[model samples]
Target: MEHANTAQLGRGPVTSSDLRRRQNGRLASIGEPLPIGMRGADAGGREGRSEAPLPLILRRVHPLILLSTVLMCLATGARAQQSSTATYSVTFQGNWTTASTPGGVVGGAHFTTLIGAVHNDQVTFWESGGTATAGVERVAELGSTGTFKSEINANSNAISVIEQSVSGGGTGSATFNVTVTSDHPRVTLLSMIGPSPDWFVGVSGRSLLNTQGNWQSPIQVDLFPYDAGTEDGTEFSLSNPATSPQGVITSIRGTGKFSNVRMARLTFTLQSAIPPPTPPPPPPGGGGFGGGGGAPRTSAPSAPRNLTAVGGDGEVVLTWEPPLRDGGADITDYEYRVDR
Candidate 1:
């Protein structure tokens, strides 16, 4: 006699046992479905039963449902492989004093408002052999960042703009923070040397990522003077004739008044990193054939490890390692309140 739930196909009713046998045979041919009742039985197997009801459950699962589950898992794996974000404290230490460059350091020597952006290889704000844009020209020649700031904001490839300056005489320092991601890891910064024609100091397209695809910290770069090639003046004076046709950007070191000494230096120190967001939990009640509750909830990451602080003349630097347990999700960010 045919069971009430036995499915009919073609000439006769197909019993659950017969369906199971056919499914198992097909799976076993592909190196799946260990003998029934064994651990790690293939997807078609059911444990602790001579002939189980899983065959009915499998029959009820639509092909589309199976495809959706597979796609979700693939997406989750891709999210887990995303890159982390990094924040750095950039310090610009100016050394363009009369003592350092006795050849032509002027009395009112100072640095204009520093302006630049963090971007990728797709766009370049300024480079050694490249011609300066209208924005770069204004920043280098007139110490104005209005045009440059607008230019940076207009570029889709640019990530963030940096604007800071040092006061007092030439030997001052300015510090600011900037964030970077794996996609846009390069930094370009420029600041004009005041009382000059079109001489500026900066780094162009400097990358912070290392060979292992991680942020490198505490990197220091010497800043040299570069001529915007827009003016023909060689001395520290503002009244100079413009280069009639304009020329390509070039280093001013060992040429005329400027010497080979570094005008300033920039230090990039890692502050914190925000890892990619955790893949969303699997949908409620697992998508598998037999519905069950979703996976257990995850907890927040543990506190950062071995945090240490070092005090400087007017600043304090803090560093720490990632938590031992990430709580099954990448850390998004770290927040700390200062008591002082």
Candidate 2:
């Protein structure tokens, strides 16, 4: 019953076969309008009885009414659109032995947070051990996140933490932010690299386009380095200078010298989704190849919730239910479509 179309004929209260199947849901009701058998010629086309407008007879033959009036003018310009998003923030600065020894990256003396394990866009708190499962073993043993922000707020999701530990480090390090309202559309970030237990830092599951209202996207990245099987890097802790680094390592499997721990380049960006222009679809079978959406769409995707295409019939597939930000798991990927 919700399938209202035919370009919503005359605007409302439909019944001319519901505006001819909202314009053409695949017409199949032959025989009705060609009953002008005796209107004894009037006004120009010459008719007289004047029963108003009751002359029809076009059930099909014209390309199924031009493909059901182009899938109801592409499902009425997709219900007059209304799904735009934007929200952002990113920062992870800490670990300094002389101010991080000019960016060699090293930490551990105590500066805990774990930030309740990310909040928005589905709590994702780092994974690369078993790869991940709620930042297991405090992100691979003692790298510390205090139970991974307590499992992203016990799975209800939404976490925030700020600690300066008596303000000697001057309230710095750990500032991951992302706040774009108006229906929300994408975000995700995480971190872990203390005393190098699991060695983690990640970002995934993103899509924040609005530009002017603000969501933005412009990413350039390079990341790879992990080895947190969970405590076995054999250390003594307190041999001479409170030692904990003899051979310095517990488990690195077949150890290729900590299997190539190198790669960290950066650049990031992603933004676009503006909603407002709806109600404009009465030109399908008559004329229209493209007009709105501002830009993006060569036809094929079908969007708004209807996936499983595997790149066949014009391609279009989507999937969800596995993304956790703030606490961080680093979602990986999921954008479905944003085409025009």
Structural similarity to truth (TM-score) of each candidate: 0.60, 0.26
Each candidate's lDDT (Cα)?
Answer: 0.64, 0.32
RMSD of each: 18.3, 17.9
Name the runs in model 2 displaced over 4 angstroms: 1-82, 90-171, 174-186, 199-231, 234-281, 284-340
Q: Residues 244-334, candidate 1, lDDT per residue (tens digit)?
A: 7999899877677766778899999999988766644666633211121123225444655655444333322344555576555444233
Residues 1-73, model 2: lDDT tens digits: 1111112122222122321211122332212342312112211121122111222222212332223322211
Give the range of the ten consecutive residues with the poorest summed lDDT in model 1. 70-79
Count of backbone clashes, every candidate in sequence: 0, 52
Model 1: how far residue 71 lies from native, Å: 22
